[model samples]
Target chain A: MSNIIRFIIKYNLVFFFLLFEVFSFYLLISYNQHHKETFLKSSGNVTASLLQLSSGFTDYFSLKEANEELSRENAYLRTLLPDNKIDKEIDDIYSIMEDSVEYIYRPAKIINNSVNRLHNYITLNKGERDGINRGDGVISARGVVGVVRYTSQNYSTVLSLLNTQLKISAKLKESNFFGTLEWNGKSYQHAILSEIPAHATVSTGDAVVSSGYSTIFPEGILIGTIQDYELISGEGFYNIRVKLSVDFKNLTYVEAVKKINKKEQLNLENRTLND
Target chain B: MISSLGKYIVNFIIIILAQVLILNNIDFGIYINPFLYLLIILSLPVNISNWLLFTTGFITGLIIDAFTNSIGLHASATVFLCFTRPYILKYFAPRDGYEPGSLPVPSHFGNAWFFKYILIGITAHHFFLFFTEAFTFTDFTTTLSKIVASTIVTSLIIMIAQMFGKRNKRR
Candidate 1:
């Protein structure tokens, strides 16, 4: 009818605004709901390839720092094994056990990363083609970084530990009293370690590391050093502040961890839980 | 010089690149995130079509989201900015109002008006963006601090950007 046309013409701008808002909100909610189903497909290949192009230029500036980090990690690894005593024997043992190694590390460059957002994510240059897959743990030379959330054929995204949604299983290295580590959306330097029993002996400067209870990370990867702690009387838990080790600001290189028998481990856990 | 439309298109590309490549990599730490990309939206002509403005806002946000890997977060916030922009213009409009087809920039509107414009617009945009990214008002103080600090940083950057490229109105 002409009346309807007139109505539309009179309020078309408002109608257009509403329409766009609804459409975009749908894109937003659908993304949050179907993250595993469609996120990579929606912004997957094309975006990552472009980010790779840009990171190519930026990666040069951080090479020295990355090299220093790699060498530091190498030095720590060296101290783990004294040089002259048993190098050849250990090498032979490593090769023999390679087939059944529990965790495999694949080096990848970070093509895109952000820390300012509440729910931050990092994108790496490696993906399914490189044997990286969803739910795999990612770590920098310094410490645990995040877990792979989605993967394209040649690119993948990590849900950075800085993200509010991610909860890393961490324990105090001193007493091995474990808790869940979470970001408070406050700063990149710190995260909150909750679920620690109030009675645990925690102190400032105590070290925190991955508990390995979550099969994603191997036992004893350093997460950070604790900065502070306080007891919540009613909750009967201590809120410990951890100073993260990995400098997300200059994060450029990382390794994706693939558990060789993760499938079997997860299935066993699920089967037990189902009962 | 190219036409104003061409200029806007060029600005659209440059601002996005600067945001994703340069500004994003600057590592201003947790407090100061400068969003100069809003320059493209804020500089849109006063009397442009509503539908076009909204679509442009959405597309700009979607592009940023694509690079950053948060598919709809920026798009949602930018759309909200576009929807409220006209009313913001009205609230801070000159008494006689904006000349038709004239772009909103400091050179055209004077520094005071333009600064106020950027202040209001960037505050709303950053608040919507940071909160939605947070997805909850539970930790209101930290989120508010981020919004406040980021808005200040973004406003100054935008104002500094406007200080350059003075328009030669007499010519």
Candidate 2:
């Protein structure tokens, strides 16, 4: 017993060092698992709320720019109101259709965001109370931003489009050849569009937009324009680089898309698969 | 000794506040993040005990982690820095050994020697931080470049801050 006591006293620092390392690693694993879970609670919520308080101070500096973006978005949305000529034309053609109100857009302010990391996230000021929920699509005035990942009572976290885990369905505006948009973890302004067939006629300036095949986003929302593309030998797909339209560095205000019939549609699809 | 203790307390608060509130907000594109908070650890009294040093590193990192939402990245890296600090100090030890109760600032030991020490410590911290945050070498070159750029920027900031620390001590 004395020998053991003497050994511990002699190497106590090393033991402490090892103990702290284990504690840190434990924190790392648990925190990452919490982030990975569909709904983050506890520590994530506390930190996100703290970030909300800090962003309140820093969010003022960008008000002018944010105001300009919001006004531009308002003008665009005004042109799409039900009384607009385009809608009247559509109403004339589809006299029997009343499902046009499938999606609703709720405006929210981004309280905190980070783009420097591999798995980037954006925290918005709206959450469950504001009708926001997980898996809903979020778009800025310029383009698609991300999908909601976690929601607290008053704040929500977005799985940014830049995240490696997020694969957005995108298509070329000209040819309508669809592909998956993914970030290469390099530049925020650029993402790669893959799975495009080699025969698709792609150019540096071709527009890329959301496919809307998934219930998250409506059809034809702008994503970006193609920067370049290549066809590797023996590969059946074209690798295209897209220049993202949304300036993630300046993303502030966004709209959360609410698909009213999303639950019914998912249920129907699941039933079909089960059958 | 009491005055020195008070000075350290003031420094600890200032460094943590500046790092979390100001420096973390300054995003110089994705490559260069200046970790000025490590300066708090870098400037500890030279003859401090290993256990105290490690604890200081862990606490400093934990506070930064809580603010940044980065979890354990800073905490682990700072602990790693504390572990290697003694060896670094031994290598850069003066011919006559360290002066009791002295700081590791450039004023106490000339600019060249202090710069070397800061460079080594900051490089270790930044390398561990950037790589561990990445958790993969899938894009090896970019991560390496990020670590290199961040190391240079952080070292420069520390050197300039040390210069100020020197001036303040003279007063």
Best by DockQ: 1
lDDT of each: 0.81, 0.80
Residue B94: error of model 2 in Å?
2.5
True contacts kept of 2: 0.38
Q: Which tens-of-lDDT digit does each residue in A1-275 have in candidate 2?
A: 99999998887767767877888878888777755552323126666666667777775666756775775466346345673334334443223122455566777888777677677778787889877899999997798999997787888878899887689999999999898999988888999999999888888998999998888987788999989888976989999999999999988778888666898999999999999
- Displacement of the residue A69 alpha carbon in candidate 2, Å: 11
- Which has the greatest lDDT? 1
**B6-121 in candidate 1: lDDT tens per residue?**
76677788788888788887777787788888988988888889889988998998888777667778888888888788889999888898777677887677888888888898
Summarize candidate 2's per-residue lDDT along B1-171 as a digit string, tens digits.
899889888989888877866787677878888999888888888889878999999988888876555567789999988877877898998899988887787778878888899899999998888888888878788889999999999999888877676767752
- Model 1, C-alpha of B9: deviation from truth (Å): 1.7
Model 2: how far is A169 from its true place, Å? Answer: 2.3
Worst 10 residues of 1 chain B by lDDT: B162-171
